[model samples]
Target: MDTDLLRTFLEVNKTRHFGRAATNLYLTQSAVSFRIRQLEIKLRTPVFTRKRGNLRLTSAGEKFVPYAENILQTWGRARQDVALTDSYQQQLTVGATSLIWEINNTNEWLEQVEAIQPEWALRTESLNRQQIPSALLEKQVDIVLTSEPPKLADLQQVRLTNFVVVLVSNEPEQNMNTIIGLPLVYLDWGTRFAVEHSRIPALQRAPILHSHGCQPALKFLINRGGVGFLPLSIAQPWIDSCKLYFVKNSPIIQNELFMVWLSSNEKYEDISVLIDVFSETQNTC
Candidate 1:
C-alpha cells in the first residue's frame, strides 16, 4: 500500500481519464497507467473498468475509497507530528482569525507569551472565520484567537481585549464628508460588526469593496484613498497626522477578542498561563 498509488487512483477516479489525471498529477499518461496496473496487481483485482472510453471504479475500488482516504489523512497528520517533534517539547497549535493576527497584532501577543513559556512550541495559523470550527473540532488547532466565541460544546472562551473600529480615510478633506461614495472597504470582522454597521448613515450610498481580511482592506484604504472602518490602534497615527479622520457620528462597533480552548483538556494548565499574561498586559497597544 503505497500512498502514491492510492493518490493516483483517487485522481483518476476524480478525472475519469488517465491522461487528464496524469496532467493534474504532473506525470506522464504511461506512468499513471503503470501505477494503476501495479495497484491492481498488488490488490489481486482490477480496480477500474476499461470498457470502451468510459473510465470508472470497479465495485472493489468503490468500497475501498473511504479506507484509502482515511489512510492518507492519518499519514498526513503523522508527518506533521514527526516534523514538530525535533524542535519542540510540546506543540501549541493556535488558530487566529486574520483580523486578530494581521490587524490587531496577535503575533506580538504570541511572542510575549512565548517569552514566558520556554518549553511550549508555538505553531500559529492565520485562519478565516469559516476555517476555525473544523480546525478546532478536529484537534488541528488547540487554541483559537477570535473576536466572537465559538458555539461548539466542550469549549471555553477567555476574554482578552475589547477594541473599537472607527471609520478612517486618506481623502484630502479627511473628514466625515468623504464617507459618501468613498468606495468603502468592508473588512469582515464578524456578524456582530456587520449588524452594528448596518445602522451607520451614508453606508447605503457607499461603493462597496469586501475584503477577506483587515490588512488588505487597510492597504486599499491608504493606497486608493477610501473610507472604511479600521481598528482604533491601527488608524490612530494617521488620525493624529491629519491624513485620516473619523467619520462624524459613525457607528462605533466594540468587539472583544477571546482565547477559546477545550475545557476538559490537560493543556489548559499551560494555556491558562498564557491567558494570564494577556490579562496583565499594558493597554498601550
Candidate 2:
C-alpha cells in the first residue's frame, strides 16, 4: 500500500472533512475523494460512511487505525536507518510547539547538542498541538517538547521545567486595576493559564487581541499599549529598558514545560542522555 494513501486516510480521520484534509495535504478535494475510493477498493470495505456534512469512520476503519500507524512508523524508522551516513551513528528528530521553542531556548539546546555530539545527526521540526502526538507515534519525531503534554499510553511525559508568566504593560505607572481596564492582548499560554484566567473577574471580558505566539503579542503590547501575560525570560529585557513593566499586584502564573517521547523507543538510554543535556543547559541558564 502506498504511504500517501495512509497519510491521506489519517488526515481525513483527523479533520473529518474531505475538503479540509485536502487543504492540509495540499491536494485537490477530488484527489482526496479518489484516494479514499482507491483505499476502499484495496481494503474491500467502505472505511467511512459519508453523509453530506458528516463523515464518520466505519468499524473497520477504527480497527485499521493502529495498523496504519504502525506501518508508517516502521517505514519511517527504516528510512532513517537506511539513510544514516558513516559520519553519524544515530539520527534524532525533535519537534516542539512554537511557544516551547521560543521560551525554552530550543535553538541554543540544539546548538549545544551539535557541540557535544558531533557524530549525532539532528533534525528539528515545528509542531502544533494536533500534530504532536501523531508525529511521535508515527516516528516522524523522536521527541517532542510541548507545554500541553499529550496523554497517550505509548508515550512517556517528563516534567522539564517551570516558566513564569506575568501580566505586564507598556505603561509603567498604571495600576493593576487601570491596566485591566485597558485593551488586553491575550496570549494562549496553555491549559493552566486558561483555567486561572477564567477565575480572574477582571479579565472576564473578551480580549482586544489574541495571539498564539509570544513575540506578536509582546510587540502589540509595546507599540499599541495594552496588558498581556509574557514569559519572564523574554520580557525581562523590555522590562529593564522601560519598554514594559510588571502589572502591580497582578497574579503570577507559572506553567510547566514537558519533554515527551515514545515509551517503547529502542533508544531510551541514548535519549535520556540528550534529556539530561537539556536539563543541564536549563539549570546553567
Candidate 3:
C-alpha cells in the first residue's frame, strides 16, 4: 500500500470535500481525485459516491477506513523511529491539554523524565483535547497526557490518576440548580464532560456557552457570572482563598487521567523509559 495514497484517503475522509483536502495536502483537486480513484481501483470497489453534490463514503470506504488509518499510522511511526535513531539523544514529543498545565505538579513530571533519561530531549506542547489522539496517531507526538482518553483504535492508555471534577461559580448565592438555569460555560473538547452533563435530567434545558480553552472558560465564569466544571486541584486554592465557591451539591464527576500513545511504539527504548518515569510519578502523585 502506498502511504501517501492512504494519507490522502484519510484526509479526504476527514474533510469530506475534495477541494478542502487538496488545500490541506498541498495538491490540486484533480490530483486528490486521481489518488482516491487509484485507491478505489486497487481495492476493486467504489469508495465514494458522486451524485447530487454529495461526497459520502460508500460501504467499502467505511469498512476500509480503520485499516487504512492503522497502516498509515504504523508507517509514520516507523519513519519517526528511524529518524530518532540518528539523533543519539532520543527525542520524545509530549502533548497535554491546557488544564493539565494549570496543575502545579505538571512540571514535576517533566523534571522526572529528565532525571530518568538524562540523554533524552523532551519536547512538550499544549494541545486541545481533541488534537491529542490525532497527534499520537500521526506520530507528531510520542505521548499524550490528558484527563480524558479519546476512543481510538490501536492505542494504549494507562491510567495516571483519578481526580474529582467540580462545578465552580463566582457568585455567592447561586447554587448548581440556579446556575444550571443560566448560561453555562463549557470547554470545546470536553466530550466526556458534555456527555455526562447531557444525562442529567435537571439540566436538560440548560443553555451552554462553549469555549475552546480552560482559561477562557474560567475567565468567562468569573467575568460573566456563569458556572463551569474544573479540576479540584485547580479550583481548591481559589475556593480556600474565597475567590470561587462550589455551586450547590453538584455531583462530583470522577475523571481518570491517562498517558496514551501508540502500542506499537511502546517497545522502543526511549518510550519505555519515559513510560516508566511517568508511571513512577503517577504513583507518587
Candidate 4:
C-alpha cells in the first residue's frame, strides 16, 4: 500500500475539495485525483461520492478513516524507532503553530533541551493553525504550542504567556490613515483580533498580503515594505537593531498562548520542565 495515496485520501477527506487538497498537499489537482483513483482501484471500492459537485465520504470510507489513521501512526512510530539513538532514553514529540514557533524560538529551545537532557530526544513539528487542535486530540504530538488552546476535554491546556503584538513597518512616522492605507501584511492573530480588526473601518478591505503566521508577514515587511503586526518580543530585537520600526499610534494587540498535552500523560514532571522551558524562554528575547 502506498502511503502517499493514503495521505492524499486523508487530505481530500479533510478539505472535501480536490483542488483545495491539492493546494494543501502541494500537488496538482489532477495528481491528487489520480492518487485517489489509484487508491480506489487498490481498495476495490469508491471511498468518496462524486455527485453534483459534492465531495463526501461513502459509508465504507467512514469506516476506513480509523484504519488509514492507524496505518499512518504505526508507520510513523516505526520510522522513529528505526532512527532512534541509543543515547536518548525518552522521546518528546512536540508541535507548534508557525507564529508560536517564532515567538518562543521553539527550534532553538529544542536544541537547548537536547543539550541539557541528552537522554531525551525532542522532535519539533510546524503545523497549520487549523491542524493543531485536532492533532493534539489524536495524540499525534505530545505537546503543542499554539496561539489558541484546544477545546477538547481529553487534553490539558496550560496558559503559557500573554504577549503584546504591535504594528510595525519600515517607516518611523505614521498616522492612522496612512498606516491603514499603506500596503499591509496582516497576520491572522486569532478570533478576538479578527473581531477587533473587523470593527476598524479602514481594515475591512483586504490587505495587500496576508499570512496565517508571523514569519512570512515579517519577511514581506522587511523586503517589500509593508506594515504588519508582530510579537513585541520578535519586533523588539529588530527595532533595537534599526531593521524595523514600530508604527506610532498604531493599534497594539494582545495574544495569549497555551501549551496543550494529553491529560492522560503520566510524565507530569517532564511536562512541567517543558512548560518551564517555554515560560522562561521569553527572557532571552
**Local distance difference test, each candidate:** 0.78, 0.83, 0.74, 0.78
What does candidate 4 score on TM?
A: 0.70
Model 3 scores a C-alpha lDDT of 0.74
For model 1, what is the C-alpha lDDT against the true structure? Answer: 0.78
- Candidate 3 lDDT over 1-285, as tens digits, reads 888889999999899899999999999999999999999989999888887567888999999987896686556555665666544457677888777766545576678678777767666767766667777776767888777777888777766666676878888766656875666776544678778878765556644677656677777777776677776776777778777788787887877667788877643556765665456444423
Ranking by TM-score: 4, 1, 2, 3
- Candidate 1 lDDT at 276 equals 69
TM-score, prediction 2: 0.68
- lDDT by residue (41-144, candidate 1, tens digit) is 99899999988799889999998776776577557656766777555667677888777886555766677767887667777776768767776876767899
By lDDT, the best candidate is 2
Clashing residue pairs in candidate 1 are none
lDDT of 3 at 136: 77
CA RMSD for every model?
Answer: 6.3, 5.4, 6.4, 5.7
lDDT of 4: 0.78
For candidate 2, lDDT tens digit of each residue in 10-115?
9999999999999999999999999999999999999999999999999999999878876876687678777989998988888988877888456666776788
Where does candidate 4 stray beyond 4 Å?
4-38, 45-74, 199-202, 236-243, 266-269, 272-284
Native-to-model Cα distance after best TM-score fit, residue 156 in candidate 3, in Å: 2.3
Q: What is the lDDT of residue 187 in candidate 3?
A: 53
Model 4: per-residue Cα lDDT over 1-285, one tens digit each: 899999999999999999999999999999999999999999999999988689999998998886897688657856885688787767787888777787754555567668777788776777777777766765668888776776777777666557778888877776567776678788887777788677666556778887877778878888888777788877887889887898776677767666788877655568777666666544333
Q: After superposition, how far is residue 73 of candidate 2 from its true place, in Å?
A: 13
